[model samples]
Target: MDKLGIYAVPAIIAAIVVFGAVKRIDLFEAFREGAKEGISSLISIAPSLIGLVIAVNMLSASGFFDIAAALLSPVCNAIGFPAELLPLGLIRPVSGSGSFAVLSSVLEKYGPDSIIGKTASVMAGSTETTFYAVAVYYGSVGIRKTRWTIPCALAADLTGMLFAVWTVRLFS
Candidate 1:
């Protein structure tokens, strides 16, 4: 499996080159153009990525997550969800680093073997950083208006968080 993984990309690229040759296309030129396009896309998306990082840092520093967690605590407790895991779930969709920071704190406080910690691990594992991904991908592609992307991704994240807790509790 490890050896196959190591050869996967080169195999895929070789297949592409062969296919392009059969199509009478300039494979090297196409590859070079793709590299250039990728770089430009990276350049275009860099600001959004940097801003996301900064915004996450600011939010983390401002204690806003703690306030949100506190406000949501009662509801979470009633639902049998740990209030401590609230911040990680809420932040996961917006910023991976921010959510991971929350997860790290939870692990530190609760220990990694604790129920909350296992749930956090599963939540982080199962969910995507929706807003961050959309911001970078859309911005790079010059998309100004997004339709249903945020809502759908957040819905998935919420569902993932619930399942993470449910599955963990099922085993425990």
Candidate 2:
């Protein structure tokens, strides 16, 4: 079953080619046209993506996240959350790559087997990069009004982070 799963994608591709042949479709030309469209789409989204990445990087570099993390520590401790996970909680919603960098730093500082490391790993997996998603997806589609997307997504991320900490303690 596991080996069959690995072959599924190839099987699907072969089926698509066979189906196209039976339909007398020019698969190669269609594929080329699709590739060109994809390239054009990339060109459209590139600027927004670059700007989003730059903003995330600026937030990480400004030492502002650290200050915010410090201010949240007392409340975190009261809830049994590890202070070290603060950066991950804050950064996870805005940028996946940024949150990943924070996760890597946490895992390195506290060995991967540590509670903090496990919590960070879980949190990373369970959260989405909300701001980046909105920027790329909405910008690509030309949606101007976000309409409660940011707040809802950030709230979900906060919920995930809290559960991750609690889950780590339950198991460890």
Candidate 3:
């Protein structure tokens, strides 16, 4: 059953493609149109994504992120998360790629089997990409008031980090 689950979506897609081809329904043209639309949408959102990347990089390089992690360290320690993961928690809510890079660095520095690595991995799984969320929501609605979203998302990420650490400790 699990194996079938892996193949199910592809199987359905393959069935549709075969059927469409056999029925002479211009399937290739339809797919090309869909691809073109996807490209256009991606292009439309390119500026927002670039701004997100630049803002994240500036925050990280300006030492604000380190300061934030330091400020949160005590509370994080109280919640069972290592002080080291505090920075990752801060970044996770703001940038998925940045968070992933932090997670990878943590894993490299403190092997995957280590408590910190496991907790970070679990946190990654439990947390949502917050900045991406804001970008999509605001971009869709044309709302520019992003001031509140970051704090709200960071709170959620912190909760997820605490939960992940606690749960991992229990099961490991």
- TM-score: which candidate is best? 1
Pick the lDDT winner: 1
lDDT of 2 by residue, 1-172 (tens): 3366469989999999999999999999999999999999878766765666566557657876578768888997898888778877877887666676677667876888798888899999988888888999999989999999888888888889889888778867
TM-score order, best first, reads 1, 2, 3
lDDT of 3 by residue, 43-86 (tens): 87667666665665676668775687688788867865677777
Candidate 3 lDDT score at position 74: 88
The whole-model lDDT of each prediction reads: 0.82, 0.81, 0.78
lDDT of 2: 0.81
- lDDT ranking, best first: 1, 2, 3
Please state the error at residue 166 of candidate 3 in Å.
0.4
Clashes of 2: 0
> After superposition on all CA atoms, what RMSD does each candidate show versus the true structure?
7.5, 7.1, 6.8
In candidate 1, how many Å is residue 135 off?
1.0
Note the residue pairs that clash in candidate 1.
none
CA shift of 97, model 2, Å: 1.6
Listed in order, each prediction's TM-score against the native is 0.60, 0.59, 0.55
In model 1, how many backbone clashes occur? Answer: 0
Output the worst ten-in-a-row residue range by lDDT, candidate 2: 48-57
Higher-TM-score candidate of 1 and 3: 1
